[model samples]
Target: MTTSTAACAFERKDWLDDYAALKTALEQRYANLAWFASPQGGVDLPALDKRTRRLLETAEDESMAKAALSAFVSGFHDGHFSTAGAVLQPKIAQPLALPKVDYSRLNATQACAALGYGPARGAAFSLPFESLPGTVLEADGLTRAFRSGVVAAPDGTRFGVVRIARFRQQDASPAACEQAWSERQAKGAMSEADVKPVKQAANAAWLRTLAAQLQHFREQKVAAVVVDVGNNPGGNDTGDWAVRLFTAHDVHSARMMMSAAPLAALYFDEQLDGLRQAQKEQDPTPEAQAMLEQSIAAFEARKAGIAARGCDLSWAWSEQRPWQPNGCSRLIDAGYASGQSSYLPPKAFGNLKIASSIYWAAEVDDLRGAWNGPVYVLTDGGTGSSAEMFSALMQDAAGARIVGRTSAGDGCGFMADAPPVVLPHSRLRYRVPNCVRLRADGNDEVAGVKPDLPVLPTEGENDRERAWRLLDTVAADLRARGAKP
Candidate 1:
């Protein structure tokens, strides 16, 4: 959104108390309170408090207090609710000028010149679309499934192009289902000795189909393979699996996050106390009390382990000290324990398998040597997380050219830290942002990855138009390079 303070509207007395209350809440959430109690631990609460106050007083839209407050809260950058519930989202401004282009040829040099800027003076000119090195014909029809103007090659035995517009849970392929079932059955029925042949056969069959497809494109003397990994919002790991047909590589990076101890403590202590007090009256039987005592012991043990880990959590969290809530001070075990709470938070693999598998495929096979064809990838704005990861890895491993706008910026990778919370008054459920999307360089900003050859289609191009532009450009480029289908 526009971070320009000049554009906002503000009034002096419109929301004085609300602003003050919001400021207090924010301070409590982020200020380092734990160090205040320690002899050597000094916190800069006063400075932080003063800074926050100043921001509020000077905020541009004091009349629209909620917006200013929310923006201020987001400034903390902790991925939590720093502002009040009244805040509204900000709007971002689009760029003033579009990139230069020609409908005829897809050459980067020509495209760059069309944009009015001089050629990237010092920038290296790698043929990003060259990732599709073996195809003779362009596969442009795959955009039907992705209505967001994705450009993909027509699925064929000779020259195949696949472009996923976004990651969607509803897009699981039947082939994926079959593969999962086969893996499960093989694991259950076959001994270690018998499993190898079965697994090999399955893998071989998959690779064979891919090999045949690549071979067809090779015969056509294709010159490139383009992958459009634009705004893919991420679907099943199968998306990565599909990418394997064109490239060889595996995703090796992994990321996971845990809640802060203080936060966890607050949740458990309050929740446990409530449970213990309720159990005392609801089920006064000796068995119930005994169970409660046992649960408390488990919680204590877990807390001790947590302390030992010495995580670099926030300072405010550290001061709470075995901070068990009222009734929960004695029995705070999680759901895995024999108490009321027994479930763990959900875990996501971030398409680890899919990533690694594709990397492996691309690394082992030399697309330039194997397929005499062009590859084109089509994507839009929904691609994120694992989808982004897939794109980054493919570009690194096979030089697969990207042919779409930047993807959604949520790919750094994240997982749900807590269950969805429905507000008592509004009945609206809110989820926490706990994942990060980063490139190999560790930059976790969003927008999306830029395309090598930027193509902004006319509105009339439609989804079909977008797809045709990518394929048509690639084919014309190939013919210029002396390749013929």
Candidate 2:
């Protein structure tokens, strides 16, 4: 990336040799190099790669070497780290709302509508439901009903509600797979190469419409079950049965791991060839043929542990004392490697796809116990990635109760299928986070889901009166823990 006679563009020493080949491809395929060597992962990465090589040695051109390659991937303050081609992932210009305009004549996605990026994804967070208190049984509540709605409480307790707005197509899609993904993106194909059987038939049609809306809120006996994912913005965290279909039991997921390199085993061998092209586009269901032969034997044991420790590794990212790979470490396959986690069972719980891509849904193990009662997710800060993986799996495997705030810190993304690091002289494109997940306090759901009850939203409050005053303070903390409401 460093040759220049100025034939075409990217001059400044070809953007500092594509920012030292994206800092040696994120220090040999990044997966949070032992959380940038811990101390609760403060992140130094060799002093942010020596201050982004002295900000790309005072680049004398190409927008300061693309702002020192986005300030060295925003100093790895990660969220699946970033970068992109043509234009996106380089916005930064927010603080200015009140009668504030002309942000240097706005452009970084309108100079920031709450932190913009690829379609400036921060705004839109509504589903009003005309001031709550019953009757919102769906009819376009965020596009024909995955917005179910309800709230009550004041000594009576009711609750129910729904609204996820995303886990990739938050529910109603199937128009012949959205016209075959708009005719394969008008021929520029690979919308994630047939997006996992078109999102395993839109997650088996939103787990049979969220198992008949959690069996119609346990026959309308609702006393708990909020799950809003407010301002959602994330999608298909392997679309895990959107937090194991609203709990009746068995939730336990997020262990996941990867990064042994060789481009993370060819990005999970292109996610095991898109699960062998969605098992040849149909014909799997002996429970989707044993969960697509156990995710093609955990993508062939994560491509033979990245080809028996596939070389090219690096660490000492200014060590605070963590880097632990005794040869391309970070695993998770010894058949769902227990004791230190790595799971997915209950018919590969949470949409690993069974009942083969919804032939009109239902019967994916009758969509799991379908609501065994008191659940509560909420969340905000525009929640993110698999909606913070269903708010950290409804606060650690469905005991639910998360309330609001502290999400959007983008917990775990890019699970399988990779191929977008490109940079050689401004071809741009970038990527990071080879895969992590964790979260059972062992941390690393990209450090996000934090609400045991944070709430926040008073000044001019409104998303339906701050989501019915945070689900009536979660029904007064479930009636001060007596909970039998």
Candidate 3:
């Protein structure tokens, strides 16, 4: 079909039909749809639909149609629920240009303060600083220096600090690096291989910088180490490296929920079976054999109950499992035990079976780490996704005090991996989250993580200055208790 014809073909009737189909599919297959649709709180689907229909009717062009769809999906209030395509990519904002700051004007004392150090004896701040006189201290300069560095407190006592702005995997393998290079080349973003480093340096720098700072803190016997993720926008979940600097005990952070109970049950079955087989091959001890048997029996019983409810497990065998769990968790309590009903009925004979074989629970763990120190995490409304995950871990696991405002609450709990749905006419794409993240308390929305010691920036104070003030406040309190080194 011609472009103009295709665009004209997407009439009100066509859009209405498509909307109905998409809504039905989400209700039937999307795991966290019910949670987002719950009466307690969730997107008002009817209202959203009304708004969407109105936008569609008045839309003057293809771009308008796409914008309407984008607005409609954003109503779900999930960061992970987003679109991606050639058309959508341009709409995404790129990183801001760093502002140039004249650090030459500031004297040594002002420079130290700018770097987050106080003038009092034994007073330390966790700001990123290189050499005192030579450092540029501009926006980008500070960012690079703060990625990892060490500086002296007023009393000549050295302190360490590492700024992790995101949680992406640093030091990707050679193959992955090459693939990224190729993609960049294809986009005409980069031309020469030599122009890029031999390896991907973004995440590697973050990891190495953090490790170096931690090592400096350990060697210098700094009073305490500060991990700054105040402006973090969140990324991967592999940020446990920072936590391991202080402790090694497993810390339970958050629980995860699958799209459906049948999918979770099938996963449990596979895990249990793998354990049973491994034990059999190892010629298990009596205790091991007994444990394996008990686990298998339990799994079998659960499967039998699901079967009795007329649920089908055949769908689990598909190569592309529509609903894949993103993170891991230990089963704390079953859905039935908590008197929680299944989000949806199980599949039976290619239809939804009217039974409660679906299992769910409240308690689950997300980011596990061993950090047992006097940790203080700085957060702001921008903290989201894996960044929020890190904040939750610091509070729930290490008992770290969170200072600053509440987090952005991006709902990494319900992460979505589904491919965007492209509109044939407008070429607009829409996406939805597939998984649901729940805290131990059974809540997963964008309400954000609250700070223990709430501190907001003053009239002219930036986040860094506010953070420095809070650190000084914390240090003062600790000193009063004779806790300073």
Which candidate achieves the best lDDT against the true structure? 2
Q: Is candidate 1 or candidate 3 better by TM-score?
A: 3
Cα error, residue 484 of model 3, in Å, equals 6.5
Off by over 4 Å in 1: 1-159, 165-170, 174-221, 228-231, 238-245, 249-374, 420-429, 445-447, 458-465, 472-485
lDDT, each prediction:
0.39, 0.60, 0.48
Error of 1 at 359 (Å): 12
Better-scoring candidate (lDDT), 1 or 2: 2
Per-prediction tally of clashes: 84, 4, 10
Q: Point out the higher-scoring one by lDDT: 2 or 3.
A: 2
Expressed as tens digits, the lDDT of each residue in 451-477 for candidate 3 is: 887877689976455555665655654
* Candidate 2: tens digits of C-alpha lDDT, residues 379-477: 777777778876887788778788778876666656556777887667788767676676777766666788888778789987777767776788899
| RMSD of each predicted structure | 18.8, 22.8, 15.1
Best by TM-score: 3
**lDDT of candidate 2?**
0.60
List model 1 lDDT by residue over 215-316, tens digit each. Answer: 655554544554445545564333433444554333233221223334445445653565455444543456445555665665555545443433332333
